[model samples]
Target: MNWLILVIAGLFEVGFTTCLKLSDNFTNFKWSAGFFICISLSFYLLNKAIQTIPLGTAYAVWTGIGAVGTVLMGIFFYKEPSDFLRLLFIFLLIGSIIGLKIVSE
Candidate 1:
């Protein structure tokens, strides 16, 4: 359940960050609302997850998910760079996240 909460929190973290960019300095009413809601939900779930998961492991996975998700969103949705080296770094980050999870478990 803790892992599940972490995953959900990560997803919401991604959503909130993306929405934050979309909010355009909080001018868009809908985006602003979504951003706030997602941010709150993400943090709440993260707090719940940390109840059982070690702080270091939970934080690592949480940030990893958010980083990867944000980069993907930038590439696919925001027309950002997709250079090979950048993608490789993202994969490396994922590898590190997985390694940490395994070690934690």
Candidate 2:
């Protein structure tokens, strides 16, 4: 389904963000390559998804997924701060994503 593809694309967005951090200004060949690959795939999939889905909806969902995923990844792997307010906002973002999914055609 298109929704599934969109979700996958959003996941790749997370991957690209992680690789971007690991790339160290693109000085690291492996992570830089990973960043390019993930970003390319993410864009390709997003293009595919937007063919049918509304642009605003797809964009919002895509960025929402990326934001939530990146935050979680930073918290878990990079030992980023995980304060209550941050977590609360993440949960709110998640709920908004889900609501968008439910309301979208």
Candidate 3:
């Protein structure tokens, strides 16, 4: 259950990060609201998750998921860079995140 919450927290972290980018520096009212709400929820869930998972491991996983997910969102939805090298780097990030999870367990 704690692990499930951690995963949910990670997803929320991704959502908030994407929302932050979409917020246009907080000028976009709707996006800014969503960003803050999601961020609050993400942290709340993260606190719950960290009750069982070590702080360092949980934080690393959370940030890794958010970072990769946000970059993917930028690439696909915002039409950010689609270079092969950039994608390869994203894949490497994904691999590192997975390695972190595995070692954490």
lDDT tens per residue, model 3, 37-57: 999999999999999889998
lDDT of 1 by residue, 1-105 (tens): 899899899999899999999999999999999999999999999999999999989999999999999999999999999999999999999999889878886
Q: After TM-score superposition, what is the CA distance of residue 63 in candidate 2 from its true location, in Å?
A: 0.4
Worst 10 residues of 1 by lDDT: 96-105
Which is the leading candidate under TM-score? Answer: 2
Clash number for candidate 2: 0
What TM-score, over all chains together, does every model reach? Answer: 0.97, 0.99, 0.88
Per-candidate local distance difference test: 0.94, 0.97, 0.87
Over 4 Å off, model 1: none
> Against the true structure, candidate 1 has what lDDT?
0.94
Q: What is the full ranking by lDDT, best candidate first? A: 2, 1, 3
The reply for model 3, stretches above 4 Å from the true place, is none
